[model samples]
Target chain A: MIWNEEYETMPRADLRALQLERLQETVERVYARVPYYRQKMEEAGVTPADIKGLDDLRRLPFTTKEDLRQNYPFGLFTVPLDRVVRVHASSGTTGKPTVVGYTKRDIRTWAELMSRTLAAAGVRRGDVVQNAYGYGLFTGGLGAHYGAENLGATVVPISGGQTKRQIQIMRDFGSTVLLSTPSYALNIADVMADLGVDPQKDLKLRVGVFGAEPWSENMREEIERRLGIKAIDIYGLSEVIGPGVAAECLEAQNGLHIFEDHFIPEIVDPTTLEPVADGEAGELVFTTITKEAFPVIRYRTKDICRLITEPCVCGRSFVRMPKITGRTDDMLIIRGVNVFPSQVEHVLMGIKGVEPHYQIVVDRQGTMDTMEVQVEVSEAVFSDEIKHLERLAQQIQRDIKDLLGVSCTVRLVEPKSIQRSEGKAKRVIDKRQL
Target chain B: MQLEQIAIFLENKAGRLAEITQILAEHGINIRAMSLADTADFGILRLIVNDTDRACQVLRDAGFTVGRTEVVVVAVPDRPGGLASVLNTLTEAELNVEYMYAFSQKSGDTGLLIFRIEDLDRARSVLQAAGHRLLSGEEVSAL
Candidate 1:
């Protein structure tokens, strides 16, 4: 069901008008309060007055992750420290994390949006939610926790890790809804098998909200079959309000409905930084219209997806986006062929006897680029005859070639050889740089 | 009789074989016979050890993919035509040997040949009917 009927079911014309008004106000607030945005606007030769309506949003300067990094801690905050009630940061593996702050009103707004997200996924007041997202700087754990609580649901703020304990809690607590990354959900299913718990018979999970990392449809099938739940794709990043920016409603499950009133969504050509036509895949960009402490204007998300303005069966008037195909940064160009790791993952997960744990190693062989996919096989499959193993490898190579149009060597490794990740699984290793 | 053999999955990289041998040495597990079948990227190291359980456990604990398969060990005379005679008998019986490896004992005129056949039971009965000595797991371990 659409959580907030007033805003969610607003007419298209009315939604656009509301978005235009908030967009103008956000532009003016950031221009006046944050110097970074002011300098950027001045450099682009555009003022808040220049923004006539939603149509003129293109004329303003684009905000990027680099800009947030340059501002570092508190330089991008629109309000004084006293007004900021909560803060969350991205992991930022390489350097400083992109920091975001929420005022009391902002937190309340976040809770409301998260409640909307959970409701779209069929979460109700009485459903027990066992949130498995990490709680610290990552923004996934507490973000889902607050949303479940806001929905008046029983919230288990267990966070991540301790696989055995997670399964026990899930069984004992009778959690009906689960929230975590799709990979972690699969890991939990694997652990359940080890602990002799039948997820289908023993556990009470009915719905799963999975997100944070891009996953394929094959993974969705795996999660559903193993856990006996309707695996719903929830999309969000720490940069964009954390886990509630958009979600797929259970009614359609076609595309994620962007909460347009809070965040205006845009699709843009990554290279030219110009808006792409609706229904065409491109980089996803967002502009927070109602954020009080951290307001972003035309922030490029770097995630690639298409915006579906088509009316969803769920009756939410907000624009919907399909599952993210790949991020601009995750695209690998080998032998002049663009290959996303997700495509490889789709092929690998579809095959039998192979686990989802895999690594794509790209290297320079003489003057040519070589891509090798190292996948792990189950112990039962690994113990097969040499000819059988060879056939399996050849089958993977042929499938990848047929699907992705890129020829890659497939190597079957032993079970438990590939490293298991606690958060986002690392899928690629490029040796060309070295 | 069926003899236990441990097969290990090893990446076709330098020092991988050395690592396995070193681990076996540290555990005081004597390697009676071994064979390596390899492709471009990986290899399978099939081994007959004095203590199959201990060797398999140690290697598996060290994160190696170890599997046990029952193989037939036929004792051949320590002569040039000893293996040829055994192959001739198997060829006449229409039995296929998947893989085989051999090693001679220092104190005997007999060599132990490990054969991985598609039909272990049939091959073992056929060899026994032909009066060929098929070593037991205990006999191979004692070697």
Candidate 2:
């Protein structure tokens, strides 16, 4: 069922050679086209010519999210605007979004990679894919959409949201493959249970491809048991060209196979920025070699995971990254949306009468992640009328949702209730075990 | 006349009401008439205490979100129709009542009903003109 059998089942030596070649080409492309990369490489005292072997990727400077933000919209893009067939933007640490562009060939490569990802997840040509990932500026929906389309499957393009309709369509459309974040999949399953629609009897879904957020093995088991489908974890960030970067094969389902032909994966110590040994957990890094429009060289992804170089039963020569354990930073992914405590602070600081002190409590209710923002009720904000307090809560909730695009419950607590740390203020208290 | 009511914000958890009661008890502040307005996440405990300033000060010092509300206390009959008659007077006068709570005197025949009227002065005058007795802050606190 491997869509790209030649690349997927290539020998280890051949895969390494291919990765080295792509890496060399990608380094040269960025150095020549992007000034940001050129200046960074010059500062690091390394040129494209220095990337002789794949091991020499460490010689080049690591491109961070800060670099992307510095470049803004199109500064890091290798290809011209006309050459780019598509653009996808994700929420940045600040208010701005990190934008990624894809050339026509880049789009084709993405489709191939995604088709390979779907094929690994057990999706065939005739399989009906109900893509529940959000479409728009966010990469999940359209990324899964084109991939499923390229795989010759009947893509429902039913982007995220609408729970009841998703269940109805799952039954009506005879969809065989479901693509969404793991939490959304669980939410759908819960809705199905409420509607009395048993997935085993009613739906024809055989496989699910979930990504965009970190999920646990227990969560995978829960989804599998409830939905009656093999839940496969797909790993990708918008920076590494969205969801097709890596995915778990149906045979192994142990770890996600990094498509090394297009992108070279690296594990590095977050603090020292030194490369970690294989199978040792560290921050996951990627170098988009085949990406013509947005070729990133040694991009530091804050996601923490280990790389398993052992050959999987799936027969893919590429290394598999085990499920992401934690993050290197304080960034949080609530229901697939990337939210930072600073962003919440940014929203809170703008509003009058609210103190800067706030705590974010992330809890998983059933399969859904519920974020409750507890802000201390200062003397200025505290009102005698319950309606005014309710209105204040609603205002905070609305503003946070408007900024982060994630709905959360805003709870106004008493002043000095949010615990203060000894040295630094601990803003986020994530109650979810995963 | 308007009576100053202490409104304290409390998280909806077990022993939260008890904690507030303990705080009032420690301060020797007698709660005259209190009503708890609650939602799923939080609750607002509105209390007419013997010492308004002391109750608010202690609650604030204890890290509780406390506020002062001006509520009108009206003396009504202890019968069932007592509430309806006072409400009807407000309805006839077109005065809006945000919220209302009651406390009956054990010895006296009249019951004191606390009303969070939109226009406190106007509602007090309307109630007084309707042959209703209004309790002063001192009189309400004494109960």
In model 2, state the lDDT of residue A230: 97
Q: What clash pairs does model 1 have?
A: none
Lowest lDDT sum, 10 consecutive residues, model 2 chain B, at B1-10
Best by DockQ: 2
TM-score per candidate, chains pooled: 0.61, 0.89
Enumerate clash totals for all models, in the order shown: 0, 0
lDDT of 1 by residue, B57-113 (tens): 999888888888988999989989888877887888899988888889877799988
Label model 1 with its docking quality class.
incorrect
Q: After superposition, how far is residue A227 of candidate 2 from its true place, in Å?
A: 3.9
> Across residues A1-434, which tens digit of lDDT does each residue of candidate 1 receive?
77799999999999999999999999999999998999999999999999887889888888887788788878999999999988898633223457999899988888898999999999999999999987876778888888889999999999877889989999999999999877778888888887889988999999999887666788788889999999999888767788899999999888899999999888899998888876889999998999999988888887899988889888899899888876777667564344678778877778875777789999866324689999876655676257877988999899888766668999887667677789878788888631
Q: What digit string (tens of lDDT, one per residue) describes model 2 on residues A142-176? A: 88888888989999988999999998898999999
Error of 2 at A69 (Å): 3.1
